[model samples]
Target: MQIREATAADWPAIWPFFHRIVAAGETFTFPTGLGEEEGRDWWLLAEPDRTVVAVDGAGTVLGTAKMNRNHMGNAAHIASASYMVDPTHTGQGVGRSLCEYSLEWARGAGYRAMQFNAVVATNSNAVRLYESLGFEVVGTLPEGFHHPVHGYVGLHVMYRLL
Candidate 1:
């Protein structure tokens, strides 16, 4: 697979995975019914921030990631990012590649560290992946997320110094 910066035209392709992941309520914290317009504005980075896509050899978008400053002004040295791999393409290393790409983007953007503010604790696969990638669970907010099926679950704040 290949990773590349995304263009606005890629949103249509990204919406499929974005919709499925958010609706599943298993990982990301986006509203289950988050509308396309809102998703577009949230995922498409026009400037300052960066957005990317992981595509297969045949050019099918397998996953996506977005990276930006974790905070404003004095806090801008840290970066924040989110990743989503197409469910149909899960377990094929798409998520891993997107994550690695996001880190590279963060480093190139001059971030001193990367922080993930709300990782669903029950999403063990993602939590494991993040850990394997060198992110540590800095803290957990008890009963922080309302998983559609798992009910209340802790959300973890993960971080890694770049």
Candidate 2:
């Protein structure tokens, strides 16, 4: 597998998985019923921010990630990122590769740290992956996210120094 910068053309390949993940309401807090255009605009960020896709040898997109500043102005030194892997591609290290790529990008771009603003507590795989990558749970807002099946759950604020 390889990680590379995403282009507008990649949106079509990304949209199916992105839409399904967001609509699942099990992990991400993204609004359900979001249209393709809006989702594309939200994920494919502009300059100074980055969007990437992970692909196999055959060039099939397996996952994607977007990295950008966690805050503006005085707090701009921090970076944040989000990831989505194709369900058929999970357990293949796609998410981890995207995350590591984002970290490298953040460090090269001079970010002091990376912070994840809203990590669903019930997403153990993600929580574990972030922890393995050196992120720590700084705080958790009780009953912050309303999981479709788990009902209300905590939203963890995860952070790590670059």
Candidate 3:
């Protein structure tokens, strides 16, 4: 698999899985009914920030990530990234590849650290991946997220130095 900057053309391939993930309301906080145009606007970030895709040998998009500053001005030294792997491609390391790519991108972009502000505590796969990658749970807002099936769950604030 290869990870590369996402182009506008990739949106079409991204939307199907993007829609499924968001609609599932299991991890991401994006509204369940978000539309394609709005999804593109939210995911396809501009320069100084980045959006990327993980693709297979046949050029099938397997996952995507968007990386940017966690906050502006004085807090700009910290970076943040969000990832979504195609459900069909899970367990194939697509998410890990995108995440590793984002970490390198953040380091190369001069970020001093990276923080994930609202990781759903119920998403064990993600929490484990982050922990394996050196991120630690700095805090958890009790019952911060409303998982579709899990009801209210904690939202973890995870962080790591670059």
Per residue, candidate 3 scores C-alpha lDDT tens digits across 19-135 of: 999999999989999999999999999998999999999999999999999998999999999999999999999988988999999999999999999999999999999999999
RMSD of model 2, in Å? Answer: 0.5
By TM-score, how accurate is candidate 2?
A: 0.99
Q: What is the per-residue lDDT of model 2 for residues 112-158, given as tens digits with 9 covering 90 to 100?
A: 99999999999999999999999999999999999999999999999
Tens digit per residue, CA lDDT, model 1, 11-103:
999998798888888888889999999998999887689899999889899999998888998998999999988889999998889888888
Model 1, position 105: C-alpha lDDT score: 83
Model 3 local distance difference test score: 0.96
lDDT for model 1: 0.91
Sliding window of 10 residues with minimal summed lDDT for model 1: 42-51
How many clashes does each candidate structure show, in the order listed? Answer: 0, 0, 0
